[model samples]
Target: MARVDVRLGRRVRDRRAVPLAISLALGLTVAALPVWATAHPAAARIAATTHPSATEPVGEPGGGVPTADPTDTGPVPTEAPTTTAPPPEATPPAGTTEPAPTTTAPQEPAPTTAAPTTGAPVPSPSVPPVRPSAPAPSPPAPPAGVHVTTDDVTLTAAYWNAPSTVATLRVTVTNTGATPARIRLAYTLPAGLTDAGTGGCAGAGGGEHRCGEWTSAPGARFSTLLRVRVSGDAWRRMPLSGSVRVTATAPGAPGPATDDEGFAVLFPPGPPVPGITLDAEEVSFDIGGGSSGLAVRLGNSGRVDAEGRIEVVLPAGVTVPAPPPGCAPAGTDRTRCSLGTVAAGRTAELRLPVSATPEAQLRAPLSGAVLGQLDPRGGRARQLRMSFRITAAAALATPMVSPPAPTGSQGVLAAGTPSVGDGRGGSARRTAILLIAVSTLLVVFALALATISLRRRLAVPSAGPPASPKP
Candidate 1:
């Protein structure tokens, strides 16, 4: 009985060993299933080759050893495991085949073990702190000056004799300085040329036109137009050829003075032999009795009668007397003495009386010109200009003394009084006249008395005194 009992115990122990080994193997396979399911294709391939019987050890709960399915299908068997493991989860549906998962190789971490063999360590690129830089220096400024220029001139001619021709000029002035500058502009015309007007410039005329004291801002420009007239007979003979100069001057400028010049040439129609001559026999006059006399003659050398005016020019403070025959006051210091129908080859005489005002300067010189035109179509006669000297006596400094009446006894006194002719004042004039008359009469009486006395002494005493002296 003891031997039979030992054989049966050995067979039972062998049966129990098979179940325990399968339980441990199933626990390990369940634990490794998720890793194999989630691994790369290479890893899957390795797991497939290394553990082909991985799931075969698991069995059903009723206690039969589970068989491996050729195609992966069905659920995992529920069995009590000998070791701890996660639950088996299904990866695919009942009918579909699950594709193998793919993954890239794990990149090795940046080598922390060794230094680089070829080059030094490439430091992580870092940006430097932003800092401001200084600014560059500025350039210097230019010098200061005034700039000037002119435009081309336009000239026109007319057949009229009064003003025969006209000329126009335009000027431009510029300020190139940083600050405001003052400028003066001047225009000079040739002889026989006169300024008619300026478009925008205010100026004075004295053979030239001058506009002054104009202020201009920096980079500012000014433009002006000037017009002139030519009326003299000389223009008929000679073509008008001259330059109109525009000058810009600044007293203390940083640059040179500027000159802008333009030239002009013009011609006008000529007239017939209209000979108009102007002459003055006496050119100079001494101021006497607050007045002076000018003897002027106008001769017509042409064959036709001349019907123009005798234009006379005089200085300021001198004027023609009232009621001057055939003479009319044209302007200040100017007179138009009309020559009514002067016959051919005849001469006309005129005595122009010019009186000086209190403002007249002593020893100053003034000029007078006599101009005449015989006919509109004829040429102008020779125009003569004469200079006059302003000479005045001491009485001119005082109030002008009235001359004696022409028809009164004072006329006789004035006619015989030499002192009155000499421009003597009232007080000294009367005394000098009286003293001269009395001394003259006394000397004549004394001479007569002495002659009579000498005659008597010589004749009568010759008879008696001669005989007595002989005895």
Candidate 2:
């Protein structure tokens, strides 16, 4: 009985040992699954590939394993959890035949997480990038070629006559540049002067005279003349002065070029006599011994006919190198000119050549005198004082030349006219008046003495007769 019981205990111990070994093998396989999946990724991919969806759990339906929730906010698995079946010798039933080997498509690589960015996000390909706009272009510059110039700009006004006086303005326009140009000239007369509407110049109002446009070829010149009438009241304002401007223009040319010229009509104060008036225009001379003319004008302002000689006394530091026709030098600084019988309302002009010495001052008051008479009777002579200034040599371009006097009444003294003595005729007339007064006084004293003697003789004769009678 003891032997039999020992044998039965040994059998029971063996059966219990089999179950312990099986539990140990299952624990080992479950722990080693993660390592096998990491090492053999291709073989372990059967769970993800064969499953209907990658998120499905690796267990049978209704098993204790949980189903993945699509709406769950849990952390996503970086790598798909790979699961594989246990080895055939460990988990398959003894009767079940091994499943035929299956084929699977290759798996694509998992997308990687991009690095954290700190700068602005890049624009999408569908939208275009914004670019800076370009700037506007500048205007073109003017051409350098076409140009116009002006020369010989002169303004002439009659110095003698005031009423019915005409002033002529002449200018020469030239295209000095290489290219031809279009030029337009306009004249602006000073105040109190009006356009005469002559010389093909039309009045554009406002004392402005406009000459129609003219085309000038290269190196060619065009001359324009404008005559304006001077009112008598305007002439009364002696030394009336102003400037004339001419503007030139052309196509593709720069701003217009202007030519400005200054002009003046000068006159001096004269004696109260209404028959004749005297005037002297301003003179200019170069500092280095240039010569200019002194224009002396004599006008007959009265309705009566008259004539006389004119004498000019120059200031110190000035000399007359050459005297005008019908004029003679009376002294170093004096010139005597004669004018024939001046008819009513007539005038004459005499231009004397004058030169300035090195000592002559510029812009200084140069005082002098002019002696003459309009009355035929000699005693009516009067002396007119005048003054002027000397300017830069370029102040005046050309000396003024006046129209000649009428025939038989020229500025030259005709034959048979009494000579006008040295300018001291006024003193001589005073001396003759004193002599006549002395002679009249002497005659009156003689008459008074004779009358007294006659009275005394008569009284004495009566007394002598009475004494004889008494004797």
Candidate 3:
């Protein structure tokens, strides 16, 4: 009976083994399902703690949903990574710095397992520590010295010093500079000097045109007017009180002592109470063809006779014909036409023809003015000024020298004579005076005193002797 029972138990065990084998295989298949699904995004997670061996099966069929390929490019599930980075760059010199090197590569980090490789280089941060030191400063300047001073002025002239003639202002300057310096002396024509500043006395006469002399210096030049405001110290002693503008530079020098010597200036004196007037405001004429004549007419136009020179500035192409025989040119600009002297309330003409010189006649503007007098010493100048232009009247026809006209007597006529009795009357009067003088002296006996006075001093001049005004 025991033998039969053992056989039966073996048969039963064999039958149970079939179900167990199937269940074991099923478990492995279920485990593999999770592993495959985990590889895909669309699956339930398997516990990471589960051992790989646990999923191994003794036996089972080999299938579930098909597994995805390993090389698929779909996004993978992952945690945000840990990384090391460089710091921010420091500010650099604006417009002044060079660019960094570009081809260089970042170096590989040092290896924990081994020494770092030389494949990539690490760029050092561009931060500069303490900036370079600053630059140095500049030095100081020098100092100034003490100032010098000027002196008072005096004047001397023909009109003022001459016996019969009117005054001719001669300005004299007395300066006080230890070092040589110029003393600028100015003379303002007392407002009512003349109607025309430069008339007879203003111009030339008796071989002396420019005749004013300074106190000491003889032939000194006049400076141009300076329009700058006078310094406070200088303004205190202005001649005419108000503000005066002049063109003259008084140079200064530094010295211990003041100089009391300066220059003297000779110029036409100012007009009388009112002023001097011209025959016309300006003298202008045109020279075209034929006879072109320029007459500078004058009128004492005031109370006294005006003495001054008239100037006509012609274009370079034109000139004045030389005077015919008899009349000699009085002054500068030889071509200058002349009126020996124009009397008060009288008229004069200076004829300069357009054909004065043989040249082309052109239509052009004459740009120049007439300055009656040329003395602008220190203060403002009372210059008789005028400007004008001439338009050509006709075309040139012929060029020839024309003969000058003849003149008549200069003074009044006698009762019997038509123009003038030859000046024999003066000689007759002098002879009568000599006869009377001899008769009176013969009776009075004063002739001896006269002879003695003449013999006493014939050479040395008196203390107040006049200084002649000629070079």
Candidate 4:
């Protein structure tokens, strides 16, 4: 019986040895897993697939174990195998002897793939914010409150005399604004009227005139008299019209203020009387050497025949050097020509050759008048005055005075008399000859004086031989 018990104990020892070998194999594989996973990343993926729940928790304080983030897009991480306690052995019943234990290899679990995570939201690309903008500017405004006014004028039969009559115009400028402003006045004269050179207005050409600036206070008014002449032909148009404009002179001011006026020309109720009108052409001549034709036109607007004498008066240094066949010198600066018995509705004209001297005043007006009678016995005389301008000629040269012609000579110059319209060659020759003759005379006088001085020295005997050597 003692020997049988020993054999049974040996069998029990053999059964325990199998379980110990299995535990040792599992521990060795777990230790080598980290080294194998580092060498082969593909093996790590397979190992992760094999044990999904074996992964450790991460991001927890004081827990060094790493875990897979559910939101991570990278490959799943692998985990090492963990050790566990062995299950307890089962005991047999007392009646039957125990059979020998069978030894078998552990079966590996099938590799499981991790399902796709679908919890955390994916973030969109970052974007920027928006903003706004700004605005524009405006324009300027104008001024207000100024007034201009003028009075009407009338001309009478007395205006149809030798010279034209001047009619006065009254213009008033008033300011209704609260502020004082400087303003200027401008006026335009219509046809058949001209500025009479009497008013304080300056001519701006083209029948326009302008006055000086005046400061006008609120509710204050000022008046100016403008004199305008009624032209000789103004009788044709009985009524005339004109306009006045007032404008502010300040910066950024408004447009102009305007007013209009009219003139009425009246004549007496009677038969049509004899009326004479005169007109002449404007002339431009040189001071020393130019001539222009002076045409005097006499128009007799009468019912019956009329007889008249036309007289021309020129300025100083101007003359009608060669009068026409029917013209004669009336005075030093006047010429008279008869217009013998001009029929009704007939016009007469006389042309005279007018000349100017070197001493003539430049830009002076040549004035004249005409006197007419309806009856040769006795009647009222009618006169008309006319004028024309004389301007300096272009390209002036040296002035030369020509000798006057002999009396009673008709358009005939004296022998060897140089005329004002002669060529430059003759003038140059005359100048050269005069200079040569004057130089020759000066040389002859100098030689005669020298000879006389020498003869006087010899006749004086040298102060009697120096008074015998001063005794």
Model 4 lDDT tens row, 1-471 = 112234345445544544454444445445444433332233233434433321222124453212222222333213111111112214423333322211111122221111112233333458443233422211111232356555555555466563667887766555544444455556777677788863335666676776544444433444556678877675444323456666543222332333223222232211134465556655557545576667767777766667867777665666888888878998897788887887767778878887876445332222222332333334566665544444444222323544332322322223443323334434544454454455455555555555554564455432222223333
Candidate 3 weakest ten by summed lDDT = 140-149
Note the clash tally of each candidate: 3, 0, 41, 0
**What's the C-alpha lDDT at position 369 in model 1?**
46
Winning candidate number (TM-score): 2
**What TM-score would each prediction reach against the true structure?**
0.26, 0.31, 0.21, 0.28
* TM-score-sorted candidate list, best first: 2, 4, 1, 3
Candidate models: Cα lDDT each: 0.44, 0.46, 0.28, 0.48
What tens digits encode model 2's per-residue C-alpha lDDT throughout 50-84?
A: 32331233344554311122232333222211111
lDDT for 367 (candidate 4): 26
**lDDT per residue, candidate 3, 164-230, as tens digits?**
2332222212221111222212222321121123211122222111211111111121211111111
**Under the 3 Å rule for N, CA and C atoms, how many clashes does model 4 have?**
0
lDDT of 1 at 209: 52
* Position 163, candidate 4: lDDT: 61
Q: Which stretches of candidate 3 lie over 4 Å from their true place?
A: 1-274, 279-288, 306-308, 324-334, 356-360, 367-383, 393-471
Question: Candidate 1 — what's its lDDT?
Answer: 0.44
For residues 1-471, write the lDDT of model 1, one tens digit per residue.
112234346445645554555455455545444433332133223434433231232233445211222221433212100111112223423333222211111132211111111223344469654456644322211223455444333332343455446655555555544444444455556566677654323334445455423444444454545576665554432322233333222322333334344333333222323455555543333444444477667677777776656766655565677727888888886788876777888887777886766444332223334555555346444442322233334212333544422321321232322222233333444443454455455555555655554554455422222222333
The predictions' CA RMSDs to the true structure, in order, are: 66.5, 65.1, 61.9, 59.9
